[model samples]
Target: MLDRLDQLQLRQLRSALPRMLEPVMKPNHPTPEVMMASFLQAVDKTNKDIASFQEAHLRLQADGVFPRARASQKNSKGLKHWRASEHPDWANPDRKRSQIS
Candidate 1:
């Protein structure tokens, strides 16, 4: 059935998606800065457009296909800062590290 075929393809794509995102993920900082929230809002309709295109093809429904990158807020020296949140390491700059070995 076409539904089964789509499910299988979805599973495969899910496995490969992370590999594709690794390169795009920022190692030290979250990209597209949170200060640009207003900018992103202006283009919020882009996703709908992409989904419509995919629907026309009837292959992949890419409504939420892409991973969203975000930043966590941290207070440092009385100042608020944003850091890349994809990886755990950059999330909390002041987190205590323990020996795991």
Candidate 2:
């Protein structure tokens, strides 16, 4: 039947799709400094936008345009913790260590 043939073709397509898409995820090389700088710039821009939005929301509340404060999206990654003494190797780039380390 035509319906049976369609199901067979769909199964074959599903099996082939993973192989066809595998190369898309290959990692590209990028420097840590470049990534960090770009991330900082993005965070700065987001902070500015959030500040402006908060000011506008406050104005609207004062003018009785909205009854309550608006809820903003919460950051899931709460905070970062870094200790200098914890990873001495990171501080001393000259120190040689195993490749896995």
Candidate 3:
């Protein structure tokens, strides 16, 4: 039974081997200039994408909506709280705590 299984596996492998090697049989045809142009176009597109992303990110950051989530603010007990000390007004010397009327 083991010998029959091994023979079946060997036959399957032999049939699949030629298909795997088929890709290596073809030759690349693009000229160096064409390749360079394609590469440059791709690089330019990537740069434009990055620039647009950065611009959008900057705009979002300016509007205080860049991070979009507060999962990182959760504590060990899964509670989220804002720390007043991290705010700019917390360190202001002239700022006085006012009682709510």
The C-alpha TM-scores of every prediction are 0.21, 0.36, 0.38
Candidate 2: residue 34 lDDT (0-100): 59
Candidate 3, pairs of clashing residues: none
Residues 15-42 of candidate 1: C-alpha lDDT, one tens digit per residue: 5544434443535545557425534443
What is the alpha-carbon lDDT for the whole of candidate 1? Answer: 0.43
Clashes of each: 1, 0, 0
lDDT of 2 by residue, 11-100 (tens): 444454343333333355276565556556655655565555556556656765443322212343564567877877775545655544
lDDT tens digits by residue: candidate 3, 1-101? 12323454445444554444444444563676665565566556555655555565566566655244443443336665679866768765556445222
Q: What order do candidates take by lDDT, descending?
A: 3, 2, 1
Q: What TM-score would candidate 1 get against the native?
A: 0.21
Candidate 3: C-alpha RMSD after superposition:
23.3
Structure candidate 1, residue pairs in collision:
30-84
lDDT values for all models: 0.43, 0.50, 0.51
Task: Write down the worst ten-residue block by lDDT for model 1.
Answer: 64-73
Q: How do all the candidates rank in terms of TM-score, highest first?
A: 3, 2, 1
